[model samples]
Target: MLMRKTAALLLLSLPLALARPMSTLAQAPVQYNVAFPNAVHHEARVTATFRELPAGPLQVRMARSSPGRYALHEFAKNVYDVAATDSRGRALTITRPDPSGWAVTGHDGTVTFTYTLFGDRTDGTYAGIDARHAHLNIPATLAYAEGLEQRPAQVQFAGLPAAWTVATQLQPDAAGTTYSAPNLQYLMDSPTSLGEQQVRTWQEGGRTIELKVLHEGTPAELDAYAAQTQKIVREAAAVFGGMPAFDFGRYTFVANYLPQTSSDGMEHRNSTSLTSRRPLRGPGAIDNLGTVAHEFFHAWNVERLRPQDLEPFNFSQANISSNLWFAEGFTQYYGELVLRRAGIYPTDTEYCQEALTGLVNAMMLSPGAARFSPVQMSQQAPFVDAAAAIDPNNRTNTYLSYYYIGAANALALDLELRARFKTDLDTYMRALWQQFGSQQQNYAPARPYTTPDLQRVLGEVARDTAFAGQFFRQHIYGHQQPDYPALLAPAGLLVRPARPNKASLATRLSFNAADSTATLGTTTSGSPLYVAGLDREDVVLRFDGQRLVGSKAFEELLSTHRPGDVVQLEVRTRTGLQTVPVTLTEEPALEVVTYEAAGRPISKAQKKFRAAWLSSKVR
Candidate 1:
């Protein structure tokens, strides 16, 4: 993504004189100084000066990964021109201790380290700087000492444009340009958006809500967007019975709705970073609101009511949690459902379409669903959830995003709970909130809920431990796919294929129109493509002696042949071109749609079930 170039840069410390005594340094705040002299190069010259240092080798490091992200970012790759010095401006001996760390030795108790970080990507997880504004995710922009993570820190945005303003969850000093964090964890969780911004504020459930927007829209457009956002927040609070005791009695949404920013939404402790390619009040508005709903729900789920395994997030390594299925998946489930209850999505058809598209169909259709349980899929997050871009790996057939699977699981459980016990997921979730999220009982690294804890909660809500055990055994841990058709039957909904008995190529392909070649993507397991030894990345040059023109041409060819027909396929792999004899087959149509099953007219009982399940009221 591209960003504007302007003069303001960020420095992460309070100003301190160089001649301060070493003992007094302990009370000195760690400060950062940043300069954007080379805006054309997309780099920021950053200097971190520490008041006091421990004896021996002091390790200065950039985070390889961060909380809320399961993947390795290797933030150090963007750092260069690293140099360290003492308070007297004398160079300290520096050496590379590891790939992601720097060691400074022989310092005169006070250390100042400087480096240049190149930032281009703008999202919840990375830093993006161009002259006009700096979007900073602290982990992506700052380096911290190995043992100084517990110290208080402050930062200043030096030389910003006169009209530009900064928005973040960090506590601001007398001057808003400078901010402070109690510790490194809070610092990393806080994302800052600086530029000409539109600020909106309202109070809900006794907490002040802030929406800081940088978008191409007028006050009216932003007002409409903020109104919808307020609806989302209010509906989410209803789910938990009340609002969380937000840190500092406030919650902030750092939104960058610019055309140049990548679309993403990341949840933090008391704030979220919302980025998108769409402006408010358009066709894309609903989708953007969905992101807002999802991230806000996270304040109760992930940011506070977190899994014990992910608490005390590690900056030097990837943070993986066993409960991401609930952490992210359940939040995704709520993100959409809240919209439906908010009147933004006012139709059942709209809700079902979103459900089938986002959750149910992803689980029912993916070949990976039959191979891995949701728990296992959550474990694969470090590899699949925004891992660094480097190599090409086949994730289509082998992996399913845990968010999809987890949401599906939540759906199945919700339906089951309503069907058997007349209770719903909201009941269970509210209990979790009161126990874990209320009273400002923020999670510590040592006090996260485990899978067993989740099960216990489910059982408690259902008033039946055995049923919860069975649900976990069959769906959470087992490879058995949830019986969606059966589960939805109780809700008076039907799940069926988009096209019945449709002839198919039985192989997914990516078409390159430039070359008119069809490259193999994921092939259905046991389908003709896999059975014939065709692998991913194999280019289809010709089908049935005709040059493969495009995906449409391939589809037309498949339409011309019936199932059980044999065809000549000219495929090119790394080995060489080979004409492989393959038999065409009717692929198991997996694309599905949900509806209030037709012809079978809804009885009064069925209507009651549907109404209760869809309503916001507790049964």
Candidate 2:
């Protein structure tokens, strides 16, 4: 009797197991057809069809956040005229569930959802469409079904002009009109550009590196830009010891340097979106390359040397991470450093004055750096990274960009390693790439790293656990700044006051010609203005008993005064009029100048150090 009972249970379970595979096999790839019927008004029609869905309401949504960005964009605001129908061509009952998405019931296992998207800004985070081209940042353009994120997706671009072509990181079908992604994550990270673009390709380390530029520049200019870009690529690769094993055996740079585009460079796993209003010639040409060097370096850092906090990036809301200082900051340091290595900046003084000075000043002079550690500053990215707000913020007093903070840290760490440990940042980065970044699995990093992991790697690279612990404690976890003047001495660089003789209020003032008064902007927390009972919107009518008549009047007064001078000001606050005595101080700004430029002697040892630090590493 027991045997018979077991046999009966087995027979019933067999049918359930058989039905599961049948159900999965029936699920079809999600299909999207994008058409630009009203391109002139920056509108496109997109239809997303999800087939063989489970028995329930289909939840469809537009992503709220994009890859490479940490803010909530609410992409659904631009979507309108939404409607849905079932496979049998019968209208489904659609309900407004939330601001970001919709719910369609009675779907009959298949739902075709359609919507109109309006996009005008051309950058890495939003979509832009016009008579000339259509730039689509995937998360800002396509809507997806909730339960079908793991299924394959197909996108087809229809109704293009005769000269238009599509450029993206998505795997293309033989027809060249449609592209496919293994899953929704990959699809959303692939930004597409449709326009008349100049295409250039070269083979690097058994992989194809391509540049697609959409610009009004001549073909010869594009060719020249491409050559410079290739040099950047080679130097970047040498840092990591080689190129990343790019998915699809290729990496692409999708650039749009038209007047209609905004300035942005967003990184993805296998590609980068480079858009700017700056053209590819004259002064703008070199400026454009700076962005290229920055974004391409991200292909190895944030895109693959993955941050555990940012791993599997969320599209529904803002993603925060504590490691952006290393992720973005280190990349910032290398971005300009690579340019110097590529011989673009040529002279050590040029690199020091232009690049290093700004970085050191931002870290050393900012009240924000004094208040928060690098980790805390990185956590604030959601509120400050391209986020929109109406009310004024005291960020100037309380915040410094993680980009600057991290680069400063990178600069210090690199020097410490070279001076003390006899190693450099390149070796540390290569170790990180081998451990956490080189292995790719299912369109993401196989081993994403946490803050602790970063510390461990540094300790290993330096072969000194105690030194690494002290560095992280003081700089990364604590707010103590590195002694920059001491660290830069080995390179024969001097950190000095940019304007030693000039006196300043240390806050920006906007002059109102009608009232012949100057109104202050946000005051630094500990500056002379803040200490003297002045704040934003306070108006100064007179300086040193002289009427402030023009924008230059206050500047002229400052020029005549020394650092230790005192000035009396007639001011109008929100409460009433008053006179205040404020002591003037030397400008806190700092500059990095070569010792040779300062008429100081440089040893052969200093020259060797500077040469090794800035010279090209490419073989």
Candidate 3:
């Protein structure tokens, strides 16, 4: 019966709201015919149609960047075999004006450009094609006319395997083969997964959630995961009062849990794409659920209540935002919390333990946290957030992940709000949802929230503008670290000195068993290794006159020593072999423990605070 219900629901199609452009000029919509005839070659033959083009040089350019990503991908590098044809079946003169676009002339007001694109990567930002199927991130696969970007678009798939299917946020025609998007931005944001799939659906608050999964799991496992995902959706909705108005009266989770695709989870306006190298089974499945919670929450935090800087996302340049600390970091903070609130973490003590152990320790131990503010790291996202690769740089010492900082800041702010104003971060987020997220406003590039807006919102939530300013100045925009030991004390988390008093060079070392060589992956900025001149990728030949065999061997040697102990190391550097003497230091000793408070009895007030913060049920 449940199986029949699920099947029936999957077959049901809902009406989609397509926003028509406000342009007065009469022009035909852009059409794309994508085919994967030779999928084994990992190529997509794409043909783009244009009507009533002006009698001049027309430029068709591939996207240099993607939405939600803050970097330039230069997608045209994979496009080849470009040619233009007129309506009379005559070839038009095509010329490469730049690396990413083609200029064509001598057409009779109608032309079609045909090109071949080779893509093998499967993630949120790139496209992938193979014998089994083709997964498309349209920004990397489709080309658009310079001035025709605002026109409506239609896409049709051809030459796919007979058993394969299509899953996207795009509005499907009655035949279900054709999908439509209001504009290029919406088109690019909608990723299509073409393959065999198992779809599951659940409805809440008059909204339907569709989970389309491509996995190797059995029907029972897939069904179970679908139910679990539905629970997660309900739990997330409980946070912001209710769901954000989904663009099409629905939200889609497009997942490719196969060994072929890379691990990633990206949030879109009406959908999210979740790809992984593993399937949803066993305990590992819980880890992937965290991503689902995170991306789903983005429907409110980023997709709608977005920063002004990222409001009108630019495809030709970087879309850097100064508020990712809140957009991405706060979402991460709540991802785990939502899981805990859903009874996924089992207990409040366990949840607090994981929070302190993972988020708090990371912020406390990260030297970069003290070096860069959360806002500064958010501004630096264009360089670190999957940006184009460059030369070797020291990110460990100089850069901190905004995700880490934002989460820690969220924790701190939540604790402070509860401690000072008797409220929590949820109140602030809910206020934003009502003002910025719930209205379902069309994509407006000029209406992003600014720092002043954030400050105002925080002030309204806490009822103290001065307190909000202090938080922004000290934590968000400035490098003053949050005093976690003091802030988290009332929550029953015990901060204590870690045992072992262990010492090391504090360098991240990777060892190859086949070659018996240990290479430094990352060395602390001022640690023994860095001071001794050990650099990243430097292959260690010997430690203390002994041939270094593995990372374990190196750690065993360090275990025998204490802070301020001198050691000798021989390394193979790019400049050649060099022997350097180094002094070790004590490893990070801050430890977080949950419940019992290190032999101290919990007071009734502290217990009340802890329960209020970690209880699964919302007030």
Q: Give me the candidate number with maximum TM-score.
A: 2
- In candidate 2, position 341 carries an lDDT of 93
Instruction: State which candidate has the highest lDDT.
Output: 2
The per-residue C-alpha lDDT of model 3 at residue 349 equals: 62
lDDT comparing candidate 2 with the true structure: 0.87
Q: How many backbone clashes does candidate 3 have?
A: 2
User: Model 2 compared with the native: what TM-score?
Assistant: 0.95
- lDDT (Cα, tens digit) per residue for candidate 1, span 1-619: 2244456555565433223344443565677777777765668888888766767888899998876888998999999999999989999999997899999999888999999889988788898876656688889988988777656667677676666787898877776667777667888888988788899999998999999999888999999989989888988988888888776788999999887788999999889999988889779999899999999999889887878788788888877777888899888888888888887887776787765545766887688888888888899988877886677776767778888888888888888888889899989999877666564432232246788988998999999999989988888887678887888776667776565555666677888788777898766677888898888889988889887777777788788887788888899987999999888776555432334435465567767777766655311
Pairs of residues clashing in candidate 2: none
RMSD of 2: 9.3
- Lowest summed lDDT across 10 adjacent residues in model 3 is found at 1-10
List all candidate RMSDs to the true structure. Answer: 3.9, 9.3, 4.4
lDDT of 2 by residue, 1-619 (tens): 0011100000000111111345443557787777776777888888888877889999999999999899899999999998899988899999989999899999989898988899999999999987788898999999988877767665565556666777899876677656667777888999989888789999987889999999988999999999889889999999999999997899999999999999999999899999999999998888789999999999999999999999788899999999999999999999999999998888999999768998899899899998899999999989998999999999989999999999999999999999999999999999999999999887899999999899999999999999889999999998898899999999999999988888998888888888788999989987888999899899999888988788676788789998878899999999899999998889888999999999999999999999999999999
Q: Show model 3 residue runs off by greater than 4 Å.
A: 1-26, 157-159, 349-355, 443-446, 497-499, 512-517, 537-541, 570-581, 597-600, 617-619
